[model samples]
Target: MNSITLEKWSDVVLPIPARYRAVITRDHKILFHETDMTPFINQDQRTFREDFMMYQFDGDNIISIVIKDMPFPPTHFDTFTDGTLLLASARCVRTDDWIQKNAGRYSLDGECLYKFVLGDGISAVAIDDEDTIWAGYYEEGVYGNYGWDEPIGSSGLVAFSSKGEVLFRPHLPMINELYYLNIQKANSIFAYYSLFSAIIHLDHFGRVQHSEIEEVMEVGPITIINESLITYDYHSKLLWSLKKQEGVYKKDKAFALKDQEGNDLYSEESAIRIRGNWLFVLNDSGIYRVELTMRMLEE
Candidate 1:
């Protein structure tokens, strides 16, 4: 089996008491979430929280962002170049309550500058280089769920301006559910959605293009390794490589995730994540990474 060795970042330590943590692959950063839970009993006896904190790690430096008096625990979030934070949550049952917006813009001091509904079933949220927010929705989000008569993400993918204005929505008919979204810079976007298994490529000026891959990978996003496409089956932990042969991707090489010394990672492979052409694998041994390049693929 073809294998690639990961470069272990042995110096880095994932902080203890990390809750709802995720790697911001494109930004090469780690995000951690923590909430100050204070149960508030409403008239109907429903409990609610009102404060949260987001800890973002830039390599060895930790940037702690605290937002108090506004409890919006995000499932996906990232900061704009201007340092303004955009955060989003998923699948909320209280869609009728406009105050409990699933997404919002917050200041560094944890003040809610503005709040808006991103609808339900948000699988992914990404902001581009130009600070345009992109939200990817699953099946429930598009078809309308949680008291939504007209879902905000009816197209499965949506682009919003920095101030929360709806900018662009693709008219593609194949989008019933979006699984993956890779917004590279402000000019390019890559997405995989629906049951069609087709990859959509779009430009900043609204140009659209796509390529279909018949082979289905049940899990993980599409990772481009040099000129080939990589798809990992998290269930089986089998990684497959594909090259475009006559306009379609065909599987050629296979791999199993290994350590720096080429040791079997086994269950560790399940935590492997792809951001652009790099693989970020984190386990009990700490964080490890490997850059997928043309030279390494051909080796």
Candidate 2:
């Protein structure tokens, strides 16, 4: 096992209760969403007032903040090639008469570019190099439950043009939670992972290139670094490399996380984002920058 170093600890101060999603723009700007929920019980009908706030950061300084009030909470978001924002909002509760007007394109200044409807609940979104937007949906199973323990019904992956036109919608298995979506720019493939340990790869044309169902692991976010899948295991507190061999993923490496003094760093509610060669980690303690150094094992 390789040892890792987490240095340059910093704090990101935001006004929201918790962070849901974060992304680094091409220009090194940090865009993130913060959410807060309030429960209300009225005549046995339970509902929540979900507040979603958007924030932008330049280094450690907060540049802008936008508190948005909408019919549903923003579930996933990404930036277009032109720096425009794409947000997907879906109803949290299962309602029979719910319409699917759940996604929107917006400018950085909080202006709505376009609004459109999807077939199911949108969980994650990504923008390809050609400016095409890809979205992942979470459809409830027969039990009328969206939890992972329930059966998986029918979900889908969608590709849309920048003009809000649906380019293609592919049939996919019911994903429990679309945790992360990324574009492997090397092959122009859009890839996404779900909480159910399913990884789906799609070409730029929205055709399925490969799909793999692996053993359940506590992986938070995954990124393709140099064509290899890199993700942090929440249970082991180690960074793992998954390389494809013979149409399956093989464990390439494992790097254990430690502080400068060699103390183990663990957190269950941590989030990770990779920019260039550095990995940014945020947990309940603070934000940290992790650098991985590999050393050959000596016989």
Candidate 3:
């Protein structure tokens, strides 16, 4: 076995009880935000409802969480250089008041370009380095049949101009997520397999350029950086770094760690992410961060 080291950083305490569907953006600054979800059933009206909240983070600290009376949890978010932020939910809601309240921080045409609605809520969003908005939704047959008679329809991959005009929409069976390939150029987009098993490359027009899904041991959470892909399997606490070459593929074990003594960490169903040098592990208990060191693969 390879050597390992694990250091517990801090616990992110959420005020309102909610499950974190996704983590949009993170940095070493005071401008971080996250989406919070709340599920409630109205006894008077007998209806189900969901709510979303925008959290502002200040250097490893959560300063405030602005709640939005939305029907769905936010799927993704993007911040502009001008201090404006765009939050996108997987599905449409009954109100956009949250956007209105933060209007002054954003540009006049911000809503026209930054806001959106998808046919379904299983969507992912990303803003390229140039500020173009790219979104992806379920494509029919994208996810394996839930039932034989269950009909799956086209999952559309869409790109919008900075001003929110639909630039392109390509019919696909499904998409995992949208990413900006800064190393490739402004015209390329990167999406991962919904289950974090593979990476798909698309152009600005939603065209596939390349794909790689090499099998890794103990599959976990995966992230794409330029041409490199990293997967952190929670089951074994093993980090796998997959590298792609011109016409060849290879995977190498990068790091390994064990869960802390008091916490019942690692879940077969939960997702994981490696940001910078920190590994984020999320479960029903909330999100936890640990510092890890990469090791050379041994024979």
Candidate 4:
């Protein structure tokens, strides 16, 4: 029943009606594939398409990139450092003779520059300035689901080069699946995985350091703010926060989110995305945002 007030970051005027595939950039811009269909699920069992458009809205300028030869519907996408895009689908199945390659790189003009297999049940995908791809998988991708006798993401985390070449795979036999991770643009990685609630920080030099926030678990999509960990409160359908100060942990708390006018924020379950210190919510109403700060932890 507790409520947290948030400062609005953007307008409710949704530019594209295809809200399911929308993504918000760190700078507050919006990007999404223009479609009316659901996302993350296999489209092969539904509507298959040979083409689609990716739209980016930056301020008043709109950039549209038309892609040909769509591979299942894209479940995750990230822009490369060199302005290209790394887009991939979630589900992949093997039929006789032909294998499904669901991930690919596309140019700004929407050309299919390269295609690769990122495995199945991919939960998250991120890229850094070095053009290194860090893909996180769920239980299915880690446990030989989707016709993969040997899942490519057996480690639950896989790093690939710009050309889809495997670069590094860590040996964390404890983690059964990757839950959430923040792979910063600088190649610094902070991840929360299954069976282990402790956050792991992976540096560029191949060193591993378990973070100090083991007090906080993957209750939902994880977000780091100052010295606190935040996720969603499934019951309240709002923000949940956990704080660590001076190496001491605080009890977890949940609170509802509202705008300056005290309007309630909408929750569509899968439409919530937390990045760095920002929370983005998508709905038919539009994209809403809130900044995560120390104040949220106090409430």
Error of 2 at 116 (Å): 1.4
TM-score of each: 0.85, 0.72, 0.58, 0.80
**Model 2: how far residue 135 lies from native, Å:** 1.2
- lDDT agreement with native, every candidate: 0.69, 0.57, 0.45, 0.69
Residues 1-299 of candidate 3: C-alpha lDDT, one tens digit per residue: 44343334435543322223434343422222343233322221113233434555533566444534433344455555454565554433223232111111233233323333433333455566566666655543233232212212133355666555667655544444432211123355655544434455566665654455556455544455545566665455666667776643357555654455544455544445543345555454455566443332232
Q: Which residue pairs in candidate 1 collide?
A: 67-110
RMSD (Å) of each candidate, 1 decimal: 3.5, 5.4, 7.5, 4.0
**How many steric overlaps does candidate 3 have?**
7
Winner of 3 and 4 under TM-score = 4
Residue 12 error for model 1, in Å? 4.7
Model 4 bad stretches (over 4 Å): 1-4, 12-20, 26-28, 36-49, 94-99, 196-198, 205-218, 244-253, 268-270, 295-299
Residues 1-299 of candidate 1: C-alpha lDDT, one tens digit per residue: 78877877545545433422455635777666754223332212123445576777666787888777544457678777767788777654453444346678887777788877666778888788888888889988888876777778888888888777889888885667888876657666777775677666677747556666766566465665445777776665777778878887777777777886777754642355666667776666667777777777777
Worst 10 residues of 1 by lDDT: 37-46
For residues 37-63, could you state the per-residue lDDT of candidate 4 as single tens digits? 455354463245667788777646779
Candidate 3's displacement at residue 205, Å, is: 5.5
Q: Which residue ranges in model 2 land beyond 4 Å of their true spot?
A: 6-9, 13-17, 24-28, 38-52, 67-69, 92-98, 141-155, 170-179, 184-198, 206-216, 259-263, 274-278, 290-299
* Better candidate number, 2 or 3, judged by TM-score: 2
Error of 3 at 17 (Å): 6.6
Ranking by TM-score: 1, 4, 2, 3
Pairs of residues at least 3 apart in sequence or in different chains that clash in candidate 4? none
